[model samples]
Target: MTATLPFTPPLALASLSGEADADWARAGAEYAGAAFLGGIALDADSRAAARELVDRDRTEFLPDDPLAFIDRELEALAETPIQPAFNVRSATVDPVVDAARVCRDREAYLEINAHCRQDELCAVGCGETLLRDGERLARYVDRAAATGATVGVKVRAEVPGVDLPDLARGLESAGADFVHVDAMDSESVIADVVDATDLFVIANNGVRGGETVREYVDYGADAVSVGRPSDNPVVLERVRDAVARQLGLEASG
Candidate 1:
């Protein structure tokens, strides 16, 4: 059976900065269906890349032991009503597998980042580089799935020559449970991806009010996630109410 999210309005808070920890998630728990923590760097190469991101004035989660960090963070959210998920970046497959095992034990979620377009991370083959290498990403998803954790991939839109829908299909075959799409400016692509695979689709980018939420819902997105402004109570309240209304509209139709 395909895995499902219990989000009533199907909205989530996207991981921002490696600083988006358990505390940040808890603060937004009442407004979110799930909370993604970290674009945590795992393994040596990805760690170095994360340091570079830090050098560029970006905050990253650079724990001495990433697996232990995952365990502790998920444990912190064990009592929170929101589903706790980790968004990880790794150049090697082993760290991803190990992290998935930790999430499995905690019954949290694991999201592979195929979304970050940072040149430093891409140079190490950790982020957007995976979008260009479908075979490797499928391998990562397949291996992570074997760990029995709920797995999803965060992908961006408008990458030159990359077909998002096709990629979603391959991920589904590889056992991914969901696809988190940062729909840059191509909001309609969510429909293509939804039609292309059974993986639950979470449409992201500029989701603050009824118009944006309704657009994604019209495009068939199963859920929507808030990014930079996820902590804004005004925005979250608007999105929450809009999504609930959309769900009601769908139910009545």
Candidate 2:
């Protein structure tokens, strides 16, 4: 896909939840000098999941004070040389508005998390549950976009019976700045998505190294993202070098 907005680093870090310390994790991510993506930062109003949410898989993060949590995370990353991105998930617009508004002020990308599959989130009509409600999801994206933050919507490419191209079109139609896709085991969806919409497409999943990054880039993704491997400085640097060569950005400059 043609990049709607230019990005020097085509490789970025994906949200890493289940970590012991969220802010500290994000700080380490930022310190890597590659682009950062904070793992699913819930909004102040996203407490809906607490009622029935079982912390299965141990990936669900419920902040005592989400705004404060985000504020601290943003503050910690303030010195990052490369612009970073933040992920936001909420069942309602007010909280997303709150989060995206702050992200706009801070010059960061605020991605709506339609990728989270925790059943707890599903009960609240947030997360991957939005995939079942495309219209609402589109409206949610539209609202997030109105905040003037760089708005992205991350989606799981292999959701049962969900039409990937159709969803991508809907998101783009609703003003999604980009669509970050967790393309599961296939890269073909990356090309399908790029062919389906004008919005920037970011390929994710199964990315183990710079060659993986190059593979996704060649598959028509405007960018690629890495998760756990980003925790390693050596691996992060290798990916960055490959991305710099692919995107022609300098490493030591």
Output the number of the lDDT-best candidate: 1
Tell me the TM-score of each prediction against the true structure: 0.96, 0.85
Whole-model lDDT, candidate 1?
Answer: 0.89
Clash count, candidate 1? 0
Per-residue lDDT over 192-238 for candidate 2, one digit per residue giving the tens place of the 0 to 100 score = 88999988888888776677778887878887777777677677677
RMSD in Å for all candidates: 2.8, 3.7
Among all candidates shown, the one with the greatest TM-score: 1
Predictions in order: lDDT: 0.89, 0.71
Looking at candidate 2, the ten consecutive residues that score lowest on lDDT are 27-36
Q: In candidate 2, which residue ranges exceed 4 Å CA deviation? A: 1-4, 18-37, 40-60
